[model samples]
Structures are given as structure tokens and as C-alpha cells.
Target chain A: MSEQAGYVPVVGAVAEPQPAPEKSYRFSEQAIQELEEILTHYPDKKSAILPALWIAQREYDGYLPPQAIQEVADRLERPFVEVEGVATFYTMYNLRKRGRHHLEVCTCLTCAVMGAYEVVHHLEKRLGVKVGQTTSDGEFTLSEVECLNYCGAATVVQVGDKYFGNITKENVDELIETLRNSNEFTPADLANAIVRLHIPERTAKK
Target chain B: MAETLVLLKHRDVPGIENIDIYEQHGGYAGLKKALAMERDAVINEIKTSGLRGRGGAGFPAWIKWSGIPKDTKKPHYVLCNADEGEPGTFKDRELMLKLPHMVIEGMIIAAYATQSAKGYIYIRGEFVESARSIRRAIDQAYKKGYLGKSICGKEGFDFDLYIHMGAGSYECGEESALMSSLMGERGQPRLKFPHAPLPIHEGVWQSPTLINNVETYAAASQILAHGGAWYATMGTENSKGTKIISVSGHVKKPGNYEVELGYPVLDMIELAGGVTGGKLKAVIPGGSSVPIIPAELCKDFKLDYDAHQVVQYSMRTMRLPVVGSGGFMVFNDKTDIVVLMRRTAEFYTHESCGKCTPCREGTRWIFKILSRITTGGGLPGDIDLLVNICDQIDGRSYCGLGDAAAWPIMGAIKHFRHEFEYWIEHKRSPVGEDCLPPAPEPLNPLLTLTPV
Candidate 1:
């Protein structure tokens, strides 16, 4: 059954303060265009929910607030509950405020055996916060995540969207310092790393 | 004892990622072969190859394609399950990253076999590089007339292919959940047995959808070009062709290695340059879901569908031999069994979709107990309680995730009960005596785009 996407404004029963209707969330023109193009790939507009949430999260500063979720649901012509259900099911979507940089350490079996726990302990001790807490300055949030699927490079860590594999206590400290000073790690750096690691000298064929 | 590189063949060739280079290296030869044949003949060719689903289930691929009703009025959809989130399994990601078109070529041929007009490559969201690579390949395929209207310039063979990015859900690797996610719903798995319709009969907006993992599609592409009979000549009985094992964890060289089925587990370890420390202590032959095998028991083990043999124990009835998704993880003696189990429990706990009761509640309960035990709060009967809880989750949960969550706990308890006992008795982890060296920093973690 197709769900209707019509909006219903909530008039708070015990309101301290409420935003005006004009303050409703909307994606930037570029994002909306990106979403529109994404919609063309799917037979049903609903299939674009995951990517739509990605666009919304990137636009709304690394987390899907209620407004962002509702805006996505409204724009995609899907029900809010459906959008929320999809959002909550995935681990990547931050429901609440995360830090400027979120460090997700892969603590699954491969990474764990490769000393992922030590990295977690090191980060927690270094950052003065537990696994899921952000620093007081709102700069970092440390989380132990399930497999990031880069098993060849065990003990992988993701800062924003960039992935650093074979992470150790030393590298973790370096990565934290780099993220602290820089707002973004350029894609060029990541691309160069992938090419270098993946392209080794020709070897004997199996 | 040599590695067999069927799927990874020519994968390391410079510029092989490009369609033109890919074609020059005999890439689209499979699709050309498939398109030239009668559709059923193509399916029969795959059937003859004896290729099983490389996604972990080991189900025969051709039979799965042929299961869809031949005369259904609704359009069939082929889904390429590139959601490679299973812990320790990065074969699909590497396959796609190195050979995106090979995977695409597999999907194109699979689409032809199933008579599907539209296909979706559902890649995991974290693979930013792979998603871009596959997108480029799809565009190139369209330009070269291998996809879209009148595929390969055959007048009536029209097919449309699109890439759908998954927003990080391990459960989406389950076929039913994958279809549900593709339909824009939460990626929780729908009930499969007893009542719910199979994806082949009623999937994705109630249309017959054929979904196969990326490795399966890549294998299928090869099978088409080489012919089923030729492909069948590789492996042992039942488990045909070469399997790519994503070997990681406590090994000297951890990476994806392709070997013919029935290759000895000991040889695989040797191929990986052996254990990191002393000798191997244990092995999680499949992904983290299957039970771990003690190194002693691994002596006669082979890398095949039914290679693992459960040792005799009173609780052995629950254990089954599994080659789940080919995520082979080796562990050395220095590894802490309790901590490993704790991490395993935490993973299922964090990933449990909360759809059904047992998995939701059971996983959390186990995780909490594990957390307590690892932190020195373990009680006397905590082992029994953990085992009992795992039994409950394993027996009645909605999907395979429940069984997966149950397996490692049972395996650890069965094999390494002393480790748990030491933790409970001494109020400390047994691993305190054997400190592992810090992991080596990745040589190159990021990859820049190579111009096509």
C-alpha cells in the first residue's frame, strides 16, 4: 500500500517554545537536485530513502535531526514513520548531535583480534570520554562499530567519511591531531593511499 | 597447494578497471556468449557449472535462477547483494573495488538468465570508492550498449540497471531484508519459512526478484564464458569452483585468497604465511556467526561446504558445519577467548534489528552478561545462564541473525570453558599474561581516483 505524504503541523499541548511554520527544514537547491536525480534511478521514490538520508545528514551537519528526517519524508512523499523506521534501523544515521568528527572504530572479529580494543581504550583514555560520548569541546565522538568491511586492512577507523585502516595507538593519536587541526581530509589523500596499497609490484599468478 | 585465481584473474592488471581495458582482457566475452545462447541454455550452462551461491548459503545458483516462474506476467528484478557487512568478510568489497565490471558483467548475465529487465546493485553505504567505481562501470556499460535498451544491439533484449546504495545495515545482507530495503522500507528481514512468500515468487513490490551476492554474480559471469562443464571441473564434489576466502585476524598475511574447494585448512594458513604469533589456537572458519573451531579440530578441515566436523559433546546436537560467507578468521593462543566472545556478543547486540523478541532481548541480555563478565562482575552460574540464553535465541528467533548470535558463545564455552572460568574466578581476563603487539599502521588507507 502506498503511504500518503501530506503534512500535519503539531500544535504543542504544553509548549515552552515552538518554531514558526516558516522555519521548516528544506534541503539546499543542489541537494534537492541530487535527490531528484537519485529518484529517477528507483522505480519507486521510496527506494531512495537511504541515499536521501545520506544527503540530508551531510547537509544537516552529520546527524539526522527530527527536522531533517521529516523534511526528507515530506520531500520524498513517504510517511514519517516509514522514514524514521529506516533511519533508526541503520547505525550510520546519527539521531542526535554528534561531534564535528565522529571516529568509528571497527571492533568486529577481524579488527578485534588486530587490537581494536586497545585502540578503543586508547581513544577513550586520550579523549577523556567513554565509547559513545563526545568530547566536551564537541570536537570528537568515539564509537566502536561493527565491521566496516575492510578486513584486509584490519583495525579500520572512519573519520567523517574517510577510512584509515591498520590503525594503531600511534596512528590513532596522529589521526586525532590531524582531524583537530583540519576541517576535512581531502579525497585526493584517500585516493592516493588506495592506489598505492592496491597496486603492488606484479607477482606470480596463482 | 597453489592458489586458484578464477575471479581475481587479470584483476591486478593495470587499468583493468576501465571497460575498454576490461574488454581487451576478454571481459564481455561471457556476456556475449550468454546473449548468443537461448536463455534456458544459459541457465543450464550455469546449472551444469555446479556453482553455489558464494554469498555464504552455498545454494546452487542456477537452480535459484530457474525457480522463478517462467511465465509470470510481472517483470522480474535481479538484485546484486553487494552489502558486504559481515565481519571479517571483505571479498565482495575487494572484488567490486578491483573488478567492478566483472561483477557487473556477472549481473548482466544473471539478469539474462532470469529474464529480468531491470537490476539493482545494492552496495553497502560505507564503500564510497566502490560505489563510485561501479557507477562509472554502469555508465560505461550503457555507452558500450551492454546495458539499457536493446542490450548488445539485440533488438528485443532490453535491460535497465541501477546502483542502489544501502545505508549501513548488516541485516540487509539477508535476502528478504535486502528486498525490503530495496522497496524503501526498514531493512529488517521478513519471515521466510512456513508462511511468507519467497523472494523469487513475490519480492520487491510483489514482483519476482532474483537476488545473488556480488561474488556469485562474478562467478556466474565467468561460468557463462567458460561453459558450465568447464567451470565444474575445479573443486570437490558438491562445492564447485574456486572460493575466495577473506582471511583476516591473527595471520601474517591477511587478505582475500582464492582456492579450490576442499583445500586443506592447514594449507590456507600456510598460504597466509602462517599464524602471527606461535601456532594458531582457534579459527572462525566462516563469518563471526558460525561456531569457532579449535586448532586441534582444524587438522582435517577442508575449505568446502561441509568441511567442518563438530566434535562429540552433549550439546553437539545444536552445532552444524557451516561455511558462512567465507570469512575465515584465525586466532592465536595469545587471544583472549572471553574478550573475543564479549566482542562477538556486543556486535550482535548492537546489530539486532529489534524486530522479534528473542533476538532483541536475548542479544542484549547476552551482551550485558558478557560486559559484566569481562569487567569482573561475572557470577558462578553466568556460564550456564549465557549458554541457556544462547539456546533460546538460537532456537526460536525470527531469522539467521539469532542463530548467528548464539553460535560463537556456544563455541567459546564448549571449547574454552576454562577461559571463562579463569575470568570469573580470578576477576581478570586470562589475556593479561600475553600482551599482543600493537597493530601495524595501514600502508595506504585512502585511495585517490585513477583517471579512466
Candidate 2:
């Protein structure tokens, strides 16, 4: 039964060894200025780590590479291990390479009970890859993440920066095509293209 | 159906996101009113209002503010926990996205009450739209003199607020973990007692800090404007005022609803357009971390904090308290209990912060056992194995997150033992057979599989 369902426990699995970096990296001028502006908010420079990581990740394609992590630590005047530790602790900071389109499907309770697993299955079937696996063409990486705080729209799927709630298999297909064919595609652009996809509901109002 | 619009009064208003529009609707009136009154009088009013923290702990808000000593030589700070990462919860996200000023106004008033010159709103990284909206609001606030020195034209009354983003750690929702993360360390909770002072006495950067939920601060602003007694008139004896509930899962309409305390949970579901399939199987009254109450037990369920005190059928063995953060999730008849329990354990295991051994090991062990049980590899005594693991992780763990990680296993086994038993006997999940896609939809060459 264990093998039949493709469910394998991550425990006892040997972790892949990370290769040492080949080159050192530094924050760009703009990112350095942004970091300085961010530092003014906190009493100490260390508090800027989270935002610094965000900037570094953006500078070096969506994921935080080892070089980028080291650069962030150097800029913030922190030890290498300390910055890496902070980076690995948070889920949003992807250490390994991710596809150009990272699709985070919320499979937590609210989304789960509302058939988010079915959406996961749909993506696996459509993309011919399982969760945590990127498509062979280096276009999409599918992961079943925890809640992204849009519980009202069950089965919420986040692509790039924008979120699409009330996702169905049909909508998922359209999402794949939209990302697959777009020339200039960020979540903000995708949000405008799929504005009508999410049905806004009545919330607490006067 | 008591539509009290204290916190969410301007939620649906289109232009309320604008500072000027918000001010037109009596938005910052609370902060102004609180600022005009004496500091002690402001504190006394909140104390009289009986407001509690909405961030799962439910600690009294006024007591936390009053704990800050006036004579402290160090600067005081106020922090708002806007990292709405708890499973099945998104109330704070909605509040921040729709009405950013109200939450910020609440923070200013709270900073004033606690005598803090600085504040921070630690928002989660996934909330891109929320963070952008709030950044715009913060900029607007500074320009309007709501944030910088000489606030509201009162000389020597200076306050500064900043919004910091957490990369993405659920444990950062814990107050101490939040502080550690803010200091660029691993987002793990510190050993509070037997070591250091309470955060209110000594917190971030060794200064007395006051940390409250976004909703709590939003409620504080309203309490100041309308007067404590007016806010106190709603809800039960102790749990006064309205609560913004984020209702989701197997409902005809799933969304956030602002309902007064002591209202029936069933009524809130109805307001959410009733159950999806016309049958309600269970309701996690708080967030997913709370015990799952079966449908029958929810007949008398109310929306207040005390309402959560009425122990359901699952509370026979493990009597856990329910000071939930208003993440009301409803499960329908088609839902598989065992699968939900497995997923819940997996979330905790993934988010265990690896600080203490009990949670780090126990959460993963519970998930492994559940995974085996669901996959037909369960031993006959797997039920006892789960209960025993939960017993160790419940109280012996370092933080509430560990205890929270343990309760669902106890509750699911206590109430839905038959579901686990069925999986073990049949060697597969009862619902897993129907839930999986039929024949994988015949993948084409364009979507070739390369199993990792």
C-alpha cells in the first residue's frame, strides 16, 4: 500500500550534498542602496536580513543561490553560516534551482478539505511531474505549500507574485497556457490577464 | 445576525483604502480620541473593555500594555503580528489588504498606550499585495504626520512605525520566534521562563516590547473611539465585542465574516452560504490546530472564546483548551478524516523549527506513523503508537506550537478511530481510491514524465 500511492516519508533519506561555490558575489548598486534604506527602519543592520534575502533572490533569478547568500551576509556584516541558516529556515527562499514559473498550490486544511489535493493531482497529470519536481523543459516547478492566507478562495494557486483563488482544473490549464506563451510575464501581469478568473465574494462589510 | 460593524465597518467601502477616504469615514477618530485623553485614562478604558489578544494566545490586551513600566530607562517598542500563516486563517490578510489604515491606526494608538516610540508590523512574505498596500499606507501616514514626531500636533509625542517581512516561517508567528527572526536568526522561540523576562518587560533589542495581533490592535482603535463600555455591550460575559471569523472549506460561500461573540457557529456557516453538499461532517471552530468537533457536537457551538470551552466528544482523553485565532474551517461528508489528519501532521512536521527535540522528532514521527497507517503499513497497535507520541509532544515540548502539533492526532484518534482502523484493515485510505485521478488523464508526449 505504501508503494502503490507513491507516498514516501522524507525521514532517513540522505540529503543531497551542496557543492562549494565557484565564485564570490556582491549585491548590485541598486540593491545596496535599497538595503541601506531598509536598514534605517530597524535599530540594527541584522534586522534587514529578510528584506535583503528578498532583494538578493530577485537579483539572482527567483531562488537564493549560495553566492547570493554569501553576498547578503557580507553586505549585512553577518557570518556566512548565520545568513544561510536564516535562508534555509524560511520556505519562500528556495535554495535549489526553481523553474521559471513556480506554482505553489496551497494544500493546507482549508484548501485540502475544499479539494486542493485534486488540483495537485490535476497539475501532476497535466505536467507529468509530481509535487516538488520541475518540468523537464525548465518552465514550471510545482510544490504543495502551506496556507497563503486566502482561505476564502479555496484551492488558491500562486504563480510568480499574484494569487488566483477558486482554481479549477480548467483554470489550471488556462494558467499553464498563459505562462507557457507569455512574452512579458510576472504575477502582476498575469493578475490582469486572469482578473476575471477569481470570483470575489462578499466579506465583512457595513 | 447582529451586524456590528466596529472592526470591519469600512471593509467593503471602495475608496476606504485611501487615507483621505478612510479619514472621512471616522477611521482615525479612535487614534485622535485616544491621543486627546490622558495616557493612563486610555489604558484604563482598554482594561475596562475586556479585550483579549486574537493571536491564538488570547492573553488580555490591556494587561500586556499595563505591564510596560513607565520608568524603564530603555526605549519601549510595539510590534504587530501580521504574519497570518496559521492554517485555515486569513483574517489579518483581508484586514490589512482591504483596510490598511485601520490596522495602522490601531498600531499608533497601541504604541501610545504602551508608551512605545517605535513599532513594526511583521507581515509574511507571501502576502505581496498586502505588503504593497501597507507600504503605501505607511508612506501616506508619515506624510500626514500620523507617524513621525509631533503626531496630531501634540508636541513631544513622537512615534515611528516600520513594516518588516518574514521570508516564510510559520514558527515566526510565535512572539519570541518573531523577535529572533527580526534579529536575523533562525525563527525559533526562545526559552521564556527560567531564563529571561516576559517580552513586555524585556523584548526585542532588550527593550520592553508590546506585541499584539493585527485584529487586536484594530479592535483597540474602535474601542477608543466608541468608548470601552459601548464595545463591551456586545458578546458574552468575558468575551466582549465582535470577532472577524475567516470561514472556509466545504461551504457554499467561503469568506471572512464579522460576527459578534456568542453568535451560533451554525449561523455563521449559514451566513457563509451553508455547507457545500448539504451535510456538515465536522467543524474546526478555531484553526486547524484546534480539535475537530463533529457535526452533532456543534449544535450548541457559539462564536465566543468560552464557547470553545464546551469540550466536544474528542475531549474525553485529551482535554485541550481552545483559545483559537478564529480560523473556522468546515469539513463536509465527502471529506476523508484520516487524510486530513495526515496532512495536518505533515504541516506541523514541516514547520517544526528543529529547536527542541520533542517537537522536531515528535512531529515528524507522528507524520511518519500516519503516513504508514494511511498507506496500509500500519501495525495493529498503531493507534496506541499515535496516542503515546502525542502524549510526549503535547506538554513536554518547548512552545505552544508543539502542543498544537500534538492535539489534532489526539482529537482525530479519539473521535475518528474507525477511520484509522479502516485504513489499517483495508490497507488503503477509504477515500483515497475515489479521490485519485482516474488513469492519469492519458499524458501526451508534450507532458512526459521523468520521475525523480
Candidate 3:
């Protein structure tokens, strides 16, 4: 994740000319309605960019592809570059596709002293992939994240919307096994949960 | 001193997240009390409570509440900073998870006092479960006439609350950066006061805005329910009331403990079941941002905002530690100060918003030097170089993130200079071969294996 530092969008770089792909829209009817409802929560349509990107992430299968950025830009009446910049600034909006479950291990100060690296190594060995790589079977994507702020349960691992705490090198296998048998789309579920939080129950019922 | 239970009084009760359970336990009484009185009286209650901001920096809460304009020329807004990104701090997570109504009730009271018709709680994206609890509480509050038009049968008083979730960015925790994020821009900060108007004057689409931490709002509700003078009876002279300290690392029973402000530091450690695994080496009294204090010096301080005064006597005191956001982390004998500082540097480096040069370049340089020292590539003048870089970034950045990045490194070098000198002299940790945080391994073996 440190590799994402000092990020500056490339401007005016020359490249071989290629035909632009035909633009397509992928947001479902419910997603459009949810985005409209979220817009009402804010004073303007541009304030809905973050939640709109979440709707896009769920519609595009857990990551923000180029078309997803374009769709969000078109919906919010903002420029593509403006939407792209906002999307990349945040860490949770994935630009690339992830596996079935995104396993983010906390490796900050308290977690490091509590042996978070050993848990990372154990997961790396079991998953047969390094940090930031998805397994060949697309079952899991492992990454070392910053603190989840649940340091009381140091060495916490966040799988989608849930945080699994008190994790150690020995007990991580059980979490992986549990994730293996589940059929939920963890990343999309995370995005959906965040989107639902923005809509009030009364508004949703309407 | 024993743990005080004010905000966490009914934390252990089952179904307290539900509105009925919360009201049964004397919740919403604060809102009812606030609604009956004049708006200025509500603000006066908070002023008398002697409560300071719990999100850190200990600013008086009443000043911000009273700063909102009385005449409603534009729509006034109230915000709750639920983006808890401090490393060892999870008190807000538990407060929202268990006592959502406390936070909502406080926000409602703030809205009434500030004459704000609409409010938004900007929660972090990672805390979906906590946000769901708040969402349920808000829905229930509406059903009971605690929200929406003419809240709680108070004629012509209308307030609406909404939750706005943030994408991942630690810079957004800063108040101005939070406002920028709330306005749907990049999560970078704007220029602060003196050069620019304060947020109270112009914020959130150029309207008067009042923003407080989750704990601060929760504490506000308590101060209004039980009179301010009654709540001000606890703690030291300068700091009053109880603070929830999130105790983590090397402690036996690591969790959130609410204690009076002036409680002794050592007593707080014992309250969390003492240091585990080995004798105590040091304690990061607050979150990762504050200065680290050696175990010997820990006895002199108390858990209050003024605890930083002790650091004035230290030899190389460029920074001081406060009861900041209450992230009390304890370290045992096996921990390595140099490695710990390296991880701390890496965090600030990754989270720097890159809006300022001193922070953007300096944090990366600090991390690079520390990474080289830890990976067996130390130079003779590297310690001085680290100090120079920290000095450059200390007060030079746009936000406190830069200052936060510099404090712990300087503090570790001030107290444990020998550990850094040992690493420079002999390219290994002075603690042992088996330090708590071992040296870094190449993240991807394939990249290292490939021919250059």
C-alpha cells in the first residue's frame, strides 16, 4: 500500500493511438434509485460521488474498472478525471478485481508488536500467494492493511464487512477455512453495506 | 483509582443498541431536557460541564456549539466525526456499536442548540457494523418523534440526521479534511483559520457547521441530562469528567476503560490487568501520534490533558504526549524501539495526503532512512539525518499528521538513543535476534527471483 504514495495522475503522455471503446452503462435500476436517494442526503449531486462509487463497485463486481469510473462520472455530471482522482485517493475503492474474499491483515504499531507479521506469513504460505496477490483459483486475495483501529484485539484481519480479531499465526487457518465454505461476495457485500448506511429506513421504504 | 463509568455506564446491558433499551436506561432524557430549555441554556449547560473535545486537542465543546450563528440565514449543519482512524483507538467503535442512541441523542441536542436543521455523521467506510447500529438508532428515533419535523413535540423545531460514509483515508480525520471529504471532493485539507474563515463561519457549502467527535457528543448528552455542575465535579482542575482510554498491546486484559481524567498512569495500566509477557519497557500514552514515554517516566504522569507538562524537563524535548484520543498502548521488554518507529514512519508516509511538500517528502525520507537502518544498511550519520528530517516536518505541514509523524520518532530517539545507536553500530537490533517485529522479508519472492 505504501507504493500508492506520491500518486500524480499522468497528463499529456504520448501513446500509440487506439480507438476508444464504445461507452456502456451497467448500473441497475435499483442502483440508480439508491444513488438518487443518496443524492438527496447531500446538498448537491457531486457530494454523492463516494456513495455512487460504492454503487458502481457493487454493480461492477467488487472493483472500479475504467467503465465504472466513467459511469460514476456520467451519473454525477462530473468529469472523468475528477471522479478518477477521488476514487484513487481512497484505499477501499479497489481499481482492480479481487478474489472471493479480500483478507486484509492489520500491520500497524500495536499489531506489529503483537506478531501480525507471523500471521501474514502463515496466510501467505497457506494461500500460496504473497501480499497483494490473489490465489490462482481466485478464492482469496491477501493484503497487509493499516490499522483497523481495533487494537484491543491486535492482529485483526478484516474479511469484507466483518473484522476477525485476536488472530494469530496458528488460528488464521480456521478463518481461511470458514471463508472457503462461504459463498458470499465479500467485497460487494462490503460496498452494499456502506451504501445502505447512507439511506434512511423511511426513505428506503418509500 | 478505580474505573469510572459515565458513558459506558450501560455498555454491558443487552439490546442497548435498540431505542427502547437505551431510553429505559435513562437515555433521551438528555434530549427531553434540552428541548424544554432555551437553546442558549442548552449551550450554557455544556459550558458549565467543563468538558473538552475527546477526539484530541481538548478544545472546549461549548465554544463550538455557541459559535454557530443564532439567526438562521442559511441552513446550519451538525457533523459527528465517527472516522476513528487512530491506530490504538477503538472507543468510538464500541460506543456506536453498543450505545448508538447516546451519540444520536447528543447530535440531536447539538442540532437544537446550534439551530441546525440538517446533520450528517461521516463514518468511516471500514466500520459498517458500527454504522448499521447508528442507522437503526436514527430510524427508531424518527419513529418516536425524536427526529424529523417538530422533534419530540417541540413546535416548529425541525432536524434531520443522515449518515455519510467515507472511503478509506486517514487525512479525512482532520476536521477541515473531513469537511472537504464531506463536500465530495478529494480528502485533502483546506487552509485553516486566520488566513481562512473558521468552519463555524463558513463550512459545508458555505453554511455554519458544528462538528464534534462521537465521544464528545455522547459526553454532551450526559452533561445536559445530569446538570453541567453535577458532571463537573470529577477530575483535576484544568480537565474535568471521565475519558474512555482504549488500552491495547502487552496488557493482559486489553479493552476500553473509562477513568477520571486525573487517574494515575500506572494505576490505569494495572486496571487493565498489568503488563503481560515481561516487565514493562515503555508506554505510548496516547495513540501512535503522541510521544512515547519510558516505563520509568510513566509513573510521573497522570491521565489528563496537562500530562504533557512533564516532557518540558526532558533533555531533547521537541514534542510532548497528551491524553490524546485515549489510545494507551503498553510495550513489554521484548519490543524493539527502532523497529516500532520504522512502522510508525511507514504509516504516516502512506497516509500523507501529499498536499504539502514538507510532509510528503519528509515522511518518505524518514521511512526510507528507518527502513535502511532496520534492513542492515545503516550509515554513521543516519541518526542525525533522521532528526534533521523530523525537524523539517515537525511544524511545517498543513495538518497535524506531519507533527504526528515526527513526534514518536523524536521521542524514541530521546529516551532510547542507545537502541538506535546499537542498530547503527552493529547492524542488528539491540534487544535480541528475536525481536517482536522481525526484519522485513521481500513481499513477493518472484520479483526478487527475477533477473535484473
Query: TM-scores of the first chain across all predictions?
Result: 0.77, 0.78, 0.91
Which CAPRI category fits model 1? acceptable
Q: List the residue pairs that clash in candidate 1.
A: A190-B446, A190-B447, A191-B447, A191-B448, A192-B448, A194-B446, A194-B447, B56-B325
Q: Which ten-residue region of model 1 chain B has the weakest summed lDDT? A: B443-452
Off by over 4 Å in 2: A1-23, A184-206, B308-318, B428-452
Across B1-452, the per-residue lDDT of candidate 2 in tens digits comes to 74567788888889788899999999889999998998888988898888989988777899988889876499999999988888888899988888999899998998887778888888887887887678778878888889989899988778988777787789999999999888778899987866768998878998999999999998998999889999889888988888888888888878788888787877877888888864888888788788887788777778777754422332334456453888989888777788788778878887888998989999888888887776668889998888878877776766788889988777777678888899888887666565322212223321111111
For each candidate, the DockQ is 0.31, 0.30, 0.47
**lDDT (tens digit, per residue) of candidate 1 on B138-235:** 87888888988889878777788877777778888888888888888888888785678778889888998898999999998899888889889999
Q: Rank the candidates by TM-score, best first.
A: 3, 2, 1
DockQ for candidate 3, please give it.
0.47
Q: What are the candidates' interface root-mean-square deviations? A: 10.6, 8.1, 4.4
Predicted candidate 2 versus true structure: per-residue lDDT over A31-115, tens digit per residue: 5666676677788888878778877776776667789888888888988788898888887777877787878888788877667
State the DockQ, from 0 to 1, for candidate 1. Answer: 0.31
Candidate 2, residue B398: Cα displacement in angstroms equals 1.9
Compared with the true structure, what per-residue lDDT tens digits does model 1 show for residues A1-206? Answer: 66657855666755676442343876877667667766776778888787788777767766777788888888889888889888988776778777777788887878877888788879878999877778999888777677998887988997754779989877889988888999653322322222222111221011
* Local accuracy by lDDT, each model: 0.80, 0.79, 0.89
- Candidate 1 vs 3: which has more lDDT: 3
